[model samples]
Target: MNITKDLVPSIAYQVRTQEGVLVDEAPVNQPLEYLHGHNNLVEGLEKALEGKAVGDVFEVRVKPEEGYGEYNDNMVQRVPKDVFMGVDELEVVCVLLRTRI
Candidate 1:
């Protein structure tokens, strides 16, 4: 399928980077879907993908400030482990992050 310009709202394959590390591959099906020119992606990545299309494989570098806001030390907080006393398994990254939902 040939995707023309402005044919966004189409999901584009996304790959993430940090300090030269390729952390994850954009999932094929659930890849980053969004309306083009609608600020659905980081400004830098969007700018890089400006003329791209589906089935297009490429890399774009996003600065921390544009991507995740440079990792604040304040985001790290110590909570009592007792918070998980009832849960048989407590996952650090995913489970602990469940609070957002």
Candidate 2:
């Protein structure tokens, strides 16, 4: 079967820098799994995996916009300490993500 939207695909992957320095990879027996066509994987990887069948292996170059997007300091928002009231061990320069149920 080919990968498509809403379908969970398992993949063994390796990441490297432009000079081919090792960055990250799936564990020896643990592959990454995610629903295809969702915003789970990077835009470039998702596009490359589209229509691919099992055991397909290939390489792709994801630009900043497609991978992580160009970082913008303007996008950062600062919340007051009171917003995290009752939370213990809060640290400076940390990221907090709010998830929707």
Q: Residues 11-81, candidate 2: write the lDDT tens digits.
A: 77777655565556775368788888978977877887888887676777776677777768898788888
Which portions of model 1 show Cα errors greater than 4 Å? 1-6, 12-26, 76-101
Per-candidate TM-score against the hidden true structure: 0.52, 0.65
The candidate that wins on lDDT is 2
Write candidate 1's Cα lDDT for 1-95 as tens digits: 43333555455343433333334444555655566566666766666667664556655556666555666779989878888778777543311
**C-alpha lDDT values of all predictions:** 0.50, 0.68
Worst 10 residues of 1 by lDDT: 92-101
Predicted structure 2: lDDT = 0.68
Once model 2 is optimally superposed onto the true structure by TM-score, how far is the C-alpha of residue 11 displaced, in angstroms?
A: 0.4
User: Cα RMSDs of all predictions?
Assistant: 7.5, 7.8
Where does candidate 2 clash, by residue pair? Answer: none
